[model samples]
Target: MESDLRIAGTNSRPDIVAWAASEDGKVVPWVVIEIKSGASSSKPEFVLPQVAQYASTLGTADNYVVMGTKWFKADRSFRRLEPVSGPTPPPFGSHGEVDDPAVVEPLLTNWLASLTREMAPRELPVGLPTLEGFSVTNEAYWRAAMRAIADTTSRSGFAQHSSSPLIAALVARLIGNRLEGLVLDPFSGVGSFLWAVADRVRGAMERGESPPNVRLLGVELEERTAAIARAIGEIAGVPTDIVAGDAFRVELPMSSAIVTAPPVGMRLPQPYELLNGRVTTDMDLAAVDLSLRHLEEGGRAVILLPRSFVYRSSGDAYREYLANEFRVGALIGTPRGAVPGTSFAGVVLVIDKGDAPGETFVGQAADDDWQVQLGVEGALTKAAVDHLDGFSEIWS
Candidate 1:
């Protein structure tokens, strides 16, 4: 939805654009949304009238929200609710608005947490609460926790790593739905994938379903990255067996699913192997082969590859390797700038181990917003493909 609004250029428009939802299995009301910069100083006087006009034009009382840095300053005209504290009294005559990002962020966070709790059961191997009470107050703590994991990996010796909240959310959705019980990230960079996967496992426990013993078995060549991955799992309460070794050579425990985000080979040291007493090849094929080996006979895998790996003239070997190993489930065409700090467009190549009767190709809209593209849309696409391909058949 954020992607649609960003690309369609209709965030501030009056019409409600109805579309399929990617967040949860539900339809969302697409009303006008105004993103203001400063909510601390301005009263809702000028903005409320404009929003009211827009809502009237659409003939819907749907939310006309303004996201900015401010607190709730209540006026008699509009009703406002603060996070924990009681309803703030109307300001003087009629100054009603929400102030303070600190106050608002936690309020929104709790609301979202509540929504998730309502949707699923609350139990886990650890029974730790989600980032609700203290975590809400200390946003930096959660971030620091994630950073600690990253720093652990970096200092340990792993040079390549990525931190992504989007991946975490996707893992959460998958675990919540019980669509997958395990996650194997063969190219687990700096343990970001481990942290995200663990976070999802925790979320599954919170959502009623007995959180599956979701083991995150990752293989990292860089020792530092392996250490970081281990530290993140410890902190997040997710069991991770992150081994420091070549992803191609390391052995993986049996699992029902795999989610890997491999290096795009944009800028990385080339791998070398002594074959017949001489080093040969760039080693790209070796990584793909490793991904295939970890997948079980009927399991599904989501592997990230450079778009060139699909159609490049020189990619015949890699393509053939894929064709010979796993069943081609779907090829999602990622858009330009889909991944941050990288120039190339990504492709989420979904694969199922062993041959299948038939396959389908889905072309989805590339989420234009960088945050939504990386966090929401990319994960959503993978989950959708998993759903369409039938998780039951893969795991059963």
Candidate 2:
């Protein structure tokens, strides 16, 4: 038995991880135990997901969630649990330690450990016990933890509309290394944009250069997602504020930058509805309109839009309006599978609230290394600087 055993591939650590030899002399973690106390000790739901997650992470099927004496025990599958028969010493007392590396590897294929992920709270929680307990000392750990949360959210079908990390990173590159003041992600699903921005800004900060002090902000529609975002933002070590509400209805601050992958097919409600002369409301257009309206003077916004948003002829007025009224810097087309949970190819619309109307910089990123295509000074960047940026124009 080991206390505070760190789980591989993640930052999660479980208490009382006990190991033993299986029937065929294979070393295995026989049982993972989690102990709870205080007022929350009685609530099984609070600890269920955590234990399950730990077990899944360790690849173990047996778990013991103990409040007092043998409170709950999980079956081999860990899909169901029942009250233990009697009070007894935890599995550690009976199991012999497994130290052989050869045997250890196979046992780890299916193991369990203590868990920290709690059930999603019914109300919007300001902080999470597990999140606070996690010691994320560096950017790499923060990134991994957030990615783990993304996997969990995606596995649960919660953040299906969230942007992929690649797209999010590309959007962050557009934000560049000079981030400051307020930054907003209207859609903010699982805080994909905010995380990407934080990562970029933190990298800059590490270099002692730009992004003096950026305040990452977001408005997420789901309570669970917003809750997770707040935790992730805190863990990211960036000054972040995430609110749970509809992005359209919530009063948002005028931001220096806005990055988002807005909903694709949701119908716009009421006076905010914008069709841009099309038969139906254009969600991307509405998102752009809302972002531009919320932007401070000279503020920049990076938005992800579907191919149709840039190609459809009915949106000519809106496109002209963008070209005429705002500084439409670039319209960079991304590789296929840019949008999560869909095969939709998309484009990154870089706009600024500056009072300038000119040709938009445009390009198509390769299947990978899109950041270099969009950022570094190269042929692609040079071409974009001139009036010859035409990746989207030619394709459309």
Candidate 3:
């Protein structure tokens, strides 16, 4: 503990530094915790941006800051945040934090600064493809690492970040029982949607039921991230194939269901035919188009996109075409800040390729806690799924 660190070009000492052993037996600092007076402006809760920098400098997996009874934490990230994003402080008593100051508090008072806590330490998770014997399939660790990467990399109000498993769960449900044949994620960032699908199928299996036999395919632009996603699937006993390439350029199959949260707000430089024989510069619209293009006749697509996509002027023609030729099953709104790196509201858009647009299910989120809107038992999601379940009766 009390290790010297070169944070912000200043020589600072952390109150406690937990160390862990790597696969090759290299001991490294695994966590950093700082104790600050609650009355001080520099309390741990107010300096997340700085703590993120600390984690980056010390190469720690998780960083903690304690002020009296309140605790704040930040995960590790190699990238640095830019100006304009400003620092959004973490809340006291964040859910699922991996630190306790009580142990350290006693040590601090007794001046036992060099002592390690009695609890067994977890192996160092040095990120994708680097840390041996570390698994990213653990949702808690996976979520922290993903959030670390997203927070440091995205510096604007409109940036594309990986969707949380919670958001993935919301989108995965719209795929319904279409698990037969190919299940695809065209813009799978770290494969949250794919994992959620696997979780759903596994849940059914646990209940001694047979879900549709399916193949999971994810197309990701980043190779390293894709590799991690693949690893997660392999470790979870779900054989997912993640392609390290662009979904738009890759050869795709006729998919039974497409579940994804594509990068938000990227515009095509030139008009692209991402839709059925149609061209548009809006990538959001184009992504949906590409999904629909590869979607089989009876397939469904569940996509999470910016709420503006629903009413954007550029999507007018595409929406019109969908209304006439395809089924727009549901549009459920998510509250602002539901997804990190994005500061605006999001819409869960569902498309059924084989059916005509019937009485569509439209629902708005009630709060920032997305579960209220998109959980398995989410009120809006339940209502919409129920509508999709019986919408065919409209024509009967």
Candidate 4:
């Protein structure tokens, strides 16, 4: 909490912060509430931009959200608005009128909390009967699998990554709804995307629901990540065919719903021999090209890459390629210092396979309140609820 405020330059002596947690004692990523008195702006005038700056600082600038006070009816009904564009001006409140924290405090907090509330088991997908159903089904099983994988691997300097809960669920829901399912993670660092998808499958089974056939695949040149991914799949009771190869050279499965996280010029030790492949000293355009190719006709994909890819002149050709092959659904830009310990700016691009596009939903997920980010964009946040939904089926 303190670090985030410091990074945003919002830390102030008058600001009293409190930690937030779930009933189960898990630290709610929502972090703390900031209560202050006698500030000239009531709510900090810079708060919205500061939050936007914080988004950029956290590499989630594309997802900008500012929750503040609002008028409430006797029954506590109120309105919450997702900031579409521009900085949220001072005197924050619903309907662009009142700014007093006294009026705004309870309402804002409630609104934020509502956005972070977890789903009840009844609201989740029905449970499956056995390990034959899917790779992941419940929180209990997923944790157990993660722990087992962690146990097998050495602790030192190993990095594991996965798709955010939102991404995972979106794919599952798409599949459940009878849309063709094809997932490709170009920057399959640690197979987070695959795990998320597996978890979604598990959720559907638990809910007594089944999805149409789907294929989950990723490219990780590093052996360590690929090995751990395979092991995780085994532990989760699902069979995953994650190959050890460069994303550019690996053949991607067809369809759409591509979700990936590419490296942002971060120099990390790769655990593979660069055999007969072009090893570039910088970001690989070939990898991006491969991503563009893998999307099936009329499919949509989201890619998480460095912010420079959004505006840099060098990436113009890539952007142009995307424009031709896929409709540019959305472009979210982030500020510097977004990812902790890394200088790269983060951005999420939503793209469709062809000229026609679906409604674009974009929002930043800061360490401050990830659940809210998910709730505010519920349409795009499927992975978060997959576990509760249960796994209905799995293909080996």
Q: TM per model?
A: 0.53, 0.62, 0.62, 0.49
Tell me how far the alpha carbon of residue 72 in candidate 4 is from the true structure, in angstroms, after superposition.
Answer: 55
Each candidate: what lDDT?
Answer: 0.48, 0.65, 0.65, 0.45
Enumerate clash totals for all models, in the order shown: 20, 3, 0, 35
lDDT score for candidate 3 against the true structure = 0.65
Q: Candidate 1: what lDDT?
A: 0.48
Cα deviation of 342, candidate 3, in Å: 0.7
True-structure RMSD for candidate 1: 12.8
Model 3 deviation from native, Cα RMSD in Å: 14.1
Candidate 3 lDDT by residue in tens digits, 1-396: 465344667666567766554444444556677667746734344566666666776676667766665565554342322222222332321222223222123322222111111231333221233223322234433344334333333333213425755677777776765567788999886677787787777667666777667679999886655755665566444567888898878998889899988787687777897445667778888888889989999889999989998898868788888888898988888888787676889888889998867867888887765666677776676677678774221110
lDDT (tens digit, per residue) of candidate 1 on 143-164? 5555433333322122236534
Candidate 3 Cα outliers beyond 4 Å, as residue runs: 1-161, 274-277, 391-396
Where in model 2 is the C-alpha error above 4 Å?
A: 1-141, 149-156, 271-280, 366-396
Q: What RMSD does model 2 have?
A: 12.7
Deviating ranges (above 4 Å) for candidate 4: 1-139, 146-156, 160-179, 237-239, 266-285, 332-343, 355-371, 375-396
Candidate 1 versus the native: TM-score?
Answer: 0.53
Question: What C-alpha lDDT does candidate 2 achieve relative to the native structure?
Answer: 0.65
